[model samples]
Target: MKKNLLWLVVFCFSISAFGQAPKHTFKLGESDFLLDGKPFQIISGELHYPRVPKEAWRERMKMAKAMGLNTIGTYVFWNLHEPQKGKFDFSGNNNIAEFVKIAQQEGLWVILRPSPYVCAEWEFGGYPYWLQNEKGLVVRSTEKQYLEEYKKYIIEVGKQLAPLQINHGGNIIMVQVENEYGSYAADKNYLDINRKMFIEAGFDGLLYTCDPAADVKDGHLAGLLPAVNGIDNPAKIRKLVNENHDGKGPYFIAEWYPAWFDWWGTAHHTVPAEQYTKKLDSVLAAGISINMYMFHGGTTRDFMNGANYKDISPYEPQTSSYDYDAPLNEAGNATEKFRQFRSVIEKHLPAGQSLPAIPAAKPSMAIAPFKLNEQVALFNMLPQAVKNATPLTFEDLKQDYGYVLYRTTIKGGKQGELQLKQLRDYAIIFINQKRAGILDRRLNQNTLSLTLPEGDVQLDIFVENMGRVNFGKYLLENKKGITEQVTFAGTEVKNWSMYGFPFKNINSYTTKPSAIQGNGPTLQKGTFKINTVADTYLDMTDWGKGVVWVNGHNLGKYWAIGPQQTLYIPKEWLKKGNNDVAVLELLKNDQQILKAIDQPILNTLKKINVE
Candidate 1:
């Protein structure tokens, strides 16, 4: 009874605004959105709930409302909500219903983009990693298994959100079909089924599909409203949309990219404020409905960060701070571009309409450098081994995030190209628990030549899921670790033991007195006292690349080779007393410490090309 009570309390607070379903009437016309026989142009801004802290959801919404936005668009991350198959989570910030309720309460409409395959550079394009394990399963296709799972997921989402839609007296005005489908494939059967499933799941309001202006022909489906993305020239965009869909109007630019997202080692992307204002002016003058792709781009945080891979480039994993170089900076602070865009928005409002005053920026403070004195080793906290003669994928072991260690006794050590077939991302190769060399999939550096001492050599290869490919055809094969057999001297050594170090129980890491002297990954722990708790950015300048957890909350990843070197630690996670801080440093295992900085270091462009 006590456990059940705890579960309910957690569920309720996580999605704090969850409530009873109510109904209204919302419909779509050829030229405009109608709210009870009136023309309504949806001026929206996209903001993912998972990316923002749950406690600040209302504040962000208020900011959006203040910025002249009538709608808040978001995508439902499948893996974030349902990490494991069969089991589902609609709790806390994961709860779209709660998020929508907050939007509604803030006098903002909702544009729910529940893309099961949301390729917003998210891991596996928002598909759960477990789906890869399903036998002969093909996602974003007409495959029965894929559809079945998609059906279950969409239906579950609908049960929670359909009632809250504007048609049902709630704030949600539009429901997006499979996100940007035109870019992925052009399967009418697949889209037809998707439309059927969404309705069956109970989304009885306006349903539409969005795609890049070029891909509209391939991705747009019949019986669904089609919208073009990223294009600013309203006339050209509409021309492109209509040429593909027989010229339907009341134009909507689904994802207007004011700026782009950041990847590790790349300079933070930004477009001049003048560029955005010019495009936005033309768009509003043409009377087009628009949703800024990310009016407020928040942090992706942790392993949830996704990657991009096309045959044209290397595997590019996104940085933790999704700042997007958007008008709203990483810390949710406004920039010069914000004011410029606000002026443009003010000019476009209807004769009698006006925007609310922009909210004041949130406060931040700097903390004195704190030392990470305690040490915890990964080797000490691993769970029981998933013994296997060969190797296994992350999905095969039913694991999602964190590092995986493949241990084996390399007999009569030989020197040659130690190759890993399709190594998912990055690997730290160790011979007898010491660093040998690194193998990264991004640079096509898959094999490392090593000189091994000839006794019974204990070979351990530690692989990090740099992040799964969220976009492109390579997504089908994003299984981490030495996926196939490791070859030494072009021979397959059989009968090896594999350890699954998924770090499922991160809190259980072994803490003991140790002469921490290895270059391998080290867990540095520390404690800091705080008389008052508030939001802070864990400055990663003093330390190297690693993940940080404060008071047991996974703050996210940090790399020295970064455009993003600070992780946002929300006040909700901090305490009034001493707060525990842990760092899992993978690059340099120096006994370094961290401090809290008032500002985030998001755009420190390191010029060394990652590829």
Candidate 2:
């Protein structure tokens, strides 16, 4: 018990001695957060640095401040920082320091939830795709390769924000370890190592672990406080936290979700602001700290978007507009939910404190439908194919997102069942350059039966990387495109030429006066001129499935079957005068023209049958 007493002495001394002066001490007490030697409350809201544009960062912070939120909780996405493993990019939009400093300037405290394995519905749960290429590497486990690589990543992050922790007089008060790991595994050794790594990374602030209340025992580490997520019954959540923390206090709801996310073919989610505001009221009234899961859910642009399941549960690709139906809409406008939430927050504010006025919404305008007059067929843009005996997965070619093409020559004839074993996501079949059929994993489709003319028929399969699984134990198998070999009936097809279409690397794609060929994928280009550009959404309601690019900046995918038909085009990506727009339509039907609209079509979930 002497050792325990010594630790208690150090803890009490740290709380007291560290509490005096400009360098504020944020310590976890028996039942409260002692900020500068007094009980403190953290009224925080979740926001992501990458989701919001670098230009609009200040405005979003202002919106959070106006909503009566005192703290901003954000997760540092790992995959974004280290896109191509070992090659890190913390400059420009990738800079998380600038985002934190901006929040501090806005008079808001910060809670840094740096989940290296963040499962925020992000691509590969924020894991770099290159990790899959590592020999014998397994993520989110006690594997040696994963731990070594994970340490390097966290150390890089520590270099940027270690000095910003609250103990160093910065706004960051609390830092999280791994995210929701108990939901996936029960490895206490992994949890212990993660805790040790965070400390080694120079995060001297109060550290904690968050998991669903049901899984607290497996997720929470000893000596560190435990926080619960998705808990509505305040008493039950608090009980779980106390049980995990040896009946200690500082009851906190790490993610009291007020809204939900959407999938590609699923309906958008929303709860009447009245329903959740009441729960917030009760939670706060009971003296429990809370963070609104997402006060302003923004967009997930380009190939950065992640998927849910592959060949299971309809291949749910998370939509671009992460607009989790929060208080602030995708365009940063104050919704009715904002007003109701503000009132509820005001009711629970400290006596003599007041909230700032809600900021005015940004301007939005609509433009006429611009025709994609120029065209380029998929077959015409092919580079020298990489000869392979069988199909290669995206990881095999070191390609993360976009499409891959496989082609072979049929000797006798092409009238048989073309079966693809372990198809990743989506694919289109062709025989002698003629569109045969589609094989979608959403409907569990793997075989395509077609008839082709006799003699040396060219068989092609263009596979698209819809997205990789962002969540679940199935993440280990998230290799995109065709994973295994293709078969003609019971026979394995060999001697194939493969092509990789990693769209991000392409600088300039040429268009020609070409006729639409063989019912295949096409690249259509259009031009729009603007005197002074403003933020607008590109309407893709009339379009089939494809990705859209504006002046070379990828605006992300769109489909006529809705939920999200309009893509948010940030003003920063636009310029004065003529701008080029390109669309890569995989299954073109009626969408020939793109419309610049005043608003987003995020809620339009149209009925689509992939089968």
RMSD to true structure for each model, in Å: 5.9, 5.0
Off by over 4 Å in 1: 1-24, 244-246, 605-611
lDDT by candidate, in order shown: 0.80, 0.83
Q: On residues 415-464, what C-alpha lDDT tens digit does candidate 1 reach at each position? A: 87788887877888888888888787767888888888889988878888
Error of 1 at 352 (Å): 2.9
Which pairs clash (backbone N, Cα, C closer than 3 Å) in model 2? Answer: 563-604
Report the C-alpha lDDT of model 2 over 542-607, residue by residue, as the tens digit.
677888888887777787666888999888778888888888888873357778898888878776
